[model samples]
Target: MMNIVQMGLGPIGQQLTRYLAEREGISIVGGIDPDPNKIGNDLGEHAGLQKIGVEIAPDLDSVALLDKADVAVITTLSSLKKVSPQIIEAAGHGLDIVSTCEELSHPWQTQPEVAKRIDEHCRKQAVSCLGTGVNPGFLMDYLPSVLTSVCQKIDKVKVERIQDAEPRRKPFRDKIGIGLTEAEFKAKRDSIRHVGVEESVRMIADAMNWQLSDVEETLELVKADRDLKNDRIDVDKGQVSGVKQVGRGYRDGKEVITLVFKAAAGVTHSHDTINISGTPTFTSTIDGGINGDIATSAITVNAICSVREAGAGLKTMLDIQVPAYFDEASP
Candidate 1:
């Protein structure tokens, strides 16, 4: 059985733990969380499951059973700088790692030096590390890049994801400013940076060997034109509902790749659409959209198998073999 350690017990982390508990050939060896309230709690209980005998530790070093772990799945935060220490600690312990850090998804574009360092460290440790999730790791970049493989000639790539925040988790709604005034939204907007669209853009551009002359990003407020009420929160008319952000990559002064993301409480359309203008132009749409939280956890867990099989170094979605559902029943 493959033993795994879960780092961070937030909503996403808890979800991943629960999912891993139900899977075969995988054992939850330990859990790491600094939250005092969560410390000492059974990992299964924290995930809303019956006790699985693993308690959450305040830190990796505190987990006496961590030696059994083959990999660490981290979902703590999005910042690469903030999460580097956790990653380094896990790597130091000689465990492979798969993190949901957005910036690390394709850090080479923005933090090349840090990426290089992490790659070197992981290489020396003889372990592999990867940063992946739904948007940056899959839909916007990986999925579109996969689609282009069949194209005889590729010119432009466009990906749009529209999400309705009404059914999303409270953290997601709050992050998108679902129920704030225009001024309140503006005030908190800077704190809510759209994590990985630019990374996704660059990933695609780099995959196609397109030298981007410029990359641009724009954010706009999605105001509530009418009153809206959801399970989590309420929004009065004229209040800020969410945001629509666009990121573009240009080559030779022409936009070669464009990514559009819109998330709000009352969005009528909810789907992921990709348009590729190539030799044989084609478009693909996933109806009802991909659930962000669920998909993030799914991809992270699925990546564990890939990371274990990959070579020792800092890896990305592009580097590892395509991930698929791991079936225990398979020979």
Candidate 2:
């Protein structure tokens, strides 16, 4: 069995613990969280799995269980300043790592030196290192590559992700500014805007050897005129409604690829689609938008698989074969 040291106890971290706990050949060995309130809590309960019999530990240092676990999974925010050291520290201790932070999936464009350092550390320790997630790693990079196998001459790539979901986290929901009028939203758009998935486009461009000259981003948020209540939350109908944001990448003034993110509680349309322009214009769509937390869980777990199979080096989703998903009752 491979022991997993889970870092971070936020929504994504909680879901990762729960989902990974269900899989075989994996065990939650220890956890690290800076939140004083969460320290020493039951890991299972922290993940809303009180019945699962795992407890959260108050340890913040990775060196404590570095010898016990084969790998570590980081589900922190995309801030490099905070996560880079954590990764290097883990690699230095001989633990393979999988992280959800952005840019790690496309280190060449975002942080080549950090990526190289992590690779060197992992190599010195004889371990593997990798980063992945739903958008940057899978949908834009790996999925597009899978589609290209059938294309004779690929011209352009377009990936659109539409997620009509509600934010259960209070801070993130407020950051989205759902109830603001078009004018108000426009007024504070830059400050209030959440980071979109543009790096995914660059990762794809790099993998396909496409020379990208420019990248542009835009947002279109639809406000709720009244209060609303649903599985995620009960908000004043007019508090800030729905949100739609798009990030596009261009090569020589031509849009080569793009990603669209949309979220709302009582909204319509929730799916992911990628269109490839080539000899036969191939288009593929997945029916559901991976729940942010669940998607993060899937990403971390997928990265773990890659780290185990890959040699001591730095890898992204482009380095592995995309796993196949089969509905158990499909027959």
Instruction: Return the top candidate by TM-score.
Output: 1
Model 2: residues with Cα > 4 Å off, grouped in runs: 50-55, 60-64, 167-175, 179-196, 225-227, 234-239, 321-331
State how far residue 177 of model 2 sits from its true place (Å). 3.1
- In terms of lDDT, the poorest run of 10 residues in model 2 is 322-331
Candidate 1: deviation at residue 262, Å? Answer: 0.5
Per-model TM against the reference: 0.97, 0.85
Task: Report the poorest 10 consecutive residues by lDDT, candidate 1.
Answer: 322-331
In the order shown, the candidates' Cα RMSDs to the true structure are 1.4, 4.1
Question: What C-alpha lDDT do the candidate models reach, one value each?
Answer: 0.89, 0.71
lDDT of 2 at 205: 77
Please report how far candidate 1 places residue 31 from its true position, in Å: 0.7
Q: How far is 172's C-alpha from truth in model 1 (Å)?
A: 1.3
Q: Candidate 1: what lDDT? A: 0.89
Q: How well is each residue in 4-80 modelled by candidate 2, as lDDT tens digits?
A: 88887787788788877877777778877878788767788888776445455555363355468788888776755
Q: Write the per-residue lDDT of candidate 1 for residues 1-331, one digit (tens) a residue.
A: 8899999999999999988988888999999999999999999999999999998999998987888888999999888989988888999999999999998998987898889989999999999999999977999999999999999999999999998878877777787787788888778878664688888998898788888999999998898888997567799989888889999999889998999999888888799999999999999999889998889999888888888889999988888988888865121
